[model samples]
Target: MHLQFITAACLLASASAHSTFQQLWINGVDAGSSCARKPASNSPVTSISSPDLACNAGAAASAGVCQVKPGDDVTVEMHQQPGDRACRNEAIGGNHYGPVLVYMAAVSDAKSAVGSNADWFKVAHMGLVSNNPDYFGSRVLNDNCGHFTFKVPAGLAPGNYLIRAEVIALHVASGSGGAQFYPACFQVNVGGTGTVKPPTVKIPGVYKASDPGILINIYQDLTTYVLPGPTAYGQASPVPATTAWPTTATWNTALQPSTVPTVVPAAGATGIGKA
Candidate 1:
């Protein structure tokens, strides 16, 4: 029985490492209604070309889409569940660290928008550090560090849009097709008077197997990590100020990640073992 228990423990730890996009909040409201993977999904979208890349394509339209003013602080939180009610950061193993990116595209209508053909515009991106050369060190995916806040441009036009959040893990990126892509999409309806149109790109076509960010190693000593994709439209000097920042905003700190204790799962032990 002892031997059997040990094996089970190792397997459970491995199981928890499955990268999944469990929850996403828009302007502080739970927006799972517009996402393809509901709160109950068991796994994340692993394929770059899966229909999910486009609003997870076929799930019926959701009522959770948000109606927001241009200056709103669109805070987004991505979490990974190791088990039911046991939530943690999106990144688990040291191998799963890279850049976190968000994009937006105006849709004809929020209620009828499915993002497959929508031309996406780069809006927000976070992957830079003055301390870490790799830009994305273990700090990105460790210790419940999966939350991000997107500031809606005050100059944005009023309309329906789809927002895409992505995190690329470069641990195995040394080889072709080795990088793992985890992306989640949100539908929103913005209400404002500003009118600054942003450039757009087609999905699946935008990301290549050989993209610089997608095929690199995070462990190597580096100085700078160039974020892939066209610079977000209208991302010029004096970016729009964040209006009414959330009291619970999770800023991507440039400081080194502080250490935190973790429960080490015993090798081959069952039931997650004793801490």
Candidate 2:
């Protein structure tokens, strides 16, 4: 009966382990925007300006619909409005022959209600599955924006890549347990080659929640990763064998006889005697 009860409990717990995540895209001018910004010239080849320009050049063309060249530097900017927010970043140009710079920003609550803590609004890169990296979260000043700049590795192969931003919303519970969180993702494109302008790709307005590849990746991580040892509270350990109590004879054999005697005495008698 005890074993049956345990089996039933385990089955019920397994049935209840179906928590899921739903990601929605924040809409505005920036929802489907590119990082590529308008350059001083539409020319393909140009001199390197500054490090920031190197990163901004590709990102601006990718997100902002600007034509970029190999050595041209571009600047990408994210503007926050009252109703919605925008994310702008860069990618490698299609014809870009030399190295390029990519600038990115991860912004949260650009228009919505973000919790009191500032760290929740930052963005970081999410690598491919089986290679998740530790993401560093930073704070963005209120009414101001957050920015990040990185040089596109020199001589990178031309291909499609996503410059993404993650937005988090905090929901406070009535009791003292903790706050809940909702996370959203946004992406843009980068294009152009050293001397050739790459064809443009249509950016998706919203994120697909039902992507099977993404689901499989997240599922594998939650199940396969194991800790070094059993949990401190023994929750993950196997149950130990139970032992029965000792018999009366066994208890008696383990004890020694006492030296004192049991006796009864008359109240008036000077000496007591056993009755």
The candidate scoring highest on TM-score is: 1
lDDT of 2 by residue, 35-150 (tens): 22222222221111222212222222222221222222221222222112222211111111111112222123222211121112111221121223211111121111222222
What TM-score against the true fold does each predicted structure earn?
Answer: 0.69, 0.22
Show model 2 residue runs off by greater than 4 Å.
Answer: 1-64, 67-144, 159-161, 169-275
Q: lDDT at 44 for candidate 1? A: 41
Write the residue-wise lDDT of candidate 1 on 101-197 in tens digits.
Answer: 7788898976676666788887767554332333352234343345566677778888888777777766566677766666766667787788977
User: Among all windows of ten consecutive residues in candidate 1, which has the lowest summed lDDT?
Assistant: 266-275
- Candidate 1 global CA lDDT score: 0.55
Cα-based lDDT at residue 140, candidate 2: 21
TM-score of 1: 0.69
> Considering only N, C-alpha and C atoms within 3 Å, which residue pairs clash in candidate 1?
5-268, 5-269, 6-268, 6-269, 7-268, 9-269, 52-56
Per-candidate clash tally: 7, 31
